[model samples]
Target: MAIQTIIVGTGRHIPAVIVPNSAFMHHQFHGPDHQPIDKPNEEILEQFEAITGIHERRYAPDDLLTSDMAFLAAEDALASSGIDRESLDGLIVAHNFGNVRPNAHRSDLVPSLAARVKARLGIRNPGAVAFDLVFGCPGWLQGVIQTDCMIRAGAARRVLVMGADTLSRVSDPHDRDSLIYADGAGAVILEGREGEPGEGILAHAARSDTFEHSTMLLMGPSYRDSAFLEAFFLKMEGRKLYRYALHHVAGAVKDCLDKAGVDLRTVAKVLIHQANLKMDEAILEALCRLAGLEGAPPGLMPMTISWLGNSSVATIPTMLDLILKGDLEGHAIRPGDTVVFASVGAGMNINAVVYRFPRS
Candidate 1:
């Protein structure tokens, strides 16, 4: 038997607040130059929806911080897997902005979100190391990859990885891209188990292009001039970012598939990051072309961006939780299925993992 790193359980926290496109109607939109946009709010929203396919998103309640959401998701994952919290060998939390309190411009990350989560879970084992990962949107997948390595190296047997982000608190309300921001959390438990070949994680790949694309997404002063000159908000070069993802993200996915020696046609599902509908579609097209497929088979990709918006790191894991629990209609992952998890974000980072469900 071979030791394989397999996901045992998953969970997600979808915030209750629903923010629709109309919610931005009264706000004045602006360009990166800090100049007011000439377009009307309705026209801008219509175009935004057509391009991003996000009609609404979720926001964490004012009282709940990013760590709080991660805790909730961790509880759910532990319960789902029925795994003892004390048995976890490590806890990894992934996020870009640390715990930013409501109406606060500064990030508070002194204790580390992973440490806070480990404490909240009441896991008293000092042997269970806790740490945070800040790898942009692909942070969560990166955590999973790290856990797999740890387990394979005999340094750990069980671990909990989470991705939680409160993008609403950091996004610029004055910028149209603010519509793409949301808040949520998701968690997964991975365990090393004796299993047969072709089980669990098969292969993975990652890349970063900081030389030319580092500023594709960065923090800057609010697009609309505010009295608080010291405050900064998340900003992005939307068109350039889109083009970059379309050009490179698919290549990363292909690299992972090749490493695993798996054919694209055999893939059952592609759990890609919920960045944008059109952009994801283009990436899929690019992947199919690179693999010599005419097009992506229908239902090959399951997405939650329309309602959940872009929850940064939480997107893929949350989508996985939904699918596993039968919450996502028209999607299911059965035994022995091959799936791909891929993401791209602020680091100008991209990663892909190929996994095969245990045959048992």
Candidate 2:
């Protein structure tokens, strides 16, 4: 008998502060002269929205930490899951910069964010394993993959997968991209179950494109591209990363569909990372072309960037929780629907998962 993993509970937590694109309009950024530079205008705001499709995002208060946010989301998931905390076999967290404290990256690597979450949850299983995964934006999905494997191997009956980040903490308030980053956390409970065929994560594709060449998409504190101020914040080669996802990632997704033995046209919904609205649209078009569809599937992809923006690793899981909770308009997952999840992020990592949403 083959075992499969099913999502028993899902949760998300967003900071209280809702920041709009207009909020950054009147703000000043670092200039070449080390002077304040404000690129504010009606046209700039309009263009920013047009290019990114991010209208607003949330920012945690100064007091809240990344682990704090993840704890809250995990609490909600455990509460709703009807699964006792003692039964959780492991905790897997996906994060990049760990916790960021205003302008500085504060990582708790010694203890690991997963262990912190495990203690916070008050789980009784001492032998339970917990760890962190740093795979950029695709991290949460990667965590999902790892947990599913553990369950199938009879290593654990249940696992908690979480993604959380406080991008605003390290974001360069003066940088134009500061508007795209925000804070949030998401969590889900995966339990091993004997399920019908075409259920659970049917197939997956994971790959890394960077080896000898530096992608220069995500970087640490350093001198930014010809900027006067130090580039301690995350930077991206937006155009190149976008093209990589569209070309290489789309092909990977096609292979994932082939591996799953499912036709692309039958995917009920595409649950993609809420990175950029425009890039998501382009990815969808590529999927359509790969599937040989005359047109992209209508209402097949739901978006959160317009409102939630990008929260690093939290994007996909948080977006999934939103749809599951019916927080997103015109998006709902009925029982026994097929879903395809894909994400591409730093490390030049790309992954796609074909899942049969549980019948509940």
Highest TM-score, which number? 1
**TM-scores for candidates 1 onward, in order:** 0.98, 0.93
For each predicted model, how many residue pairs clash, with residues at least 3 apart or on different chains?
0, 0
lDDT string for model 2 (22-64, tens) is 7876666554344544554566678779988998999988888
The whole-model lDDT of each prediction reads 0.94, 0.82
Error of 1 at 310 (Å): 0.2
* Candidate 1 TM-score versus the reference: 0.98
Q: Please write out the lDDT profile of model 1 over residues 1-360, one tens digit for every residue.
A: 889999998999999999999999999998978899999899999999999899999999999999999999999999999978999999999999999998888899989999999999889999999999999999999999999999999999999999999999998889889899999999999999988868899998999999999998988888887555445788899999999999899999999999999999999999999999999999999999999999999999998999999999999999999998999999999989999999999879999999998876
Off by over 4 Å in 2: 30-40, 103-105, 212-214, 220-231
Q: After superposition, how far is residue 135 of candidate 2 from its true place, in Å?
A: 0.2
The 10-residue segment of model 2 with minimum total lDDT is 220-229
Residue pairs with clashing backbones, model 1:
none
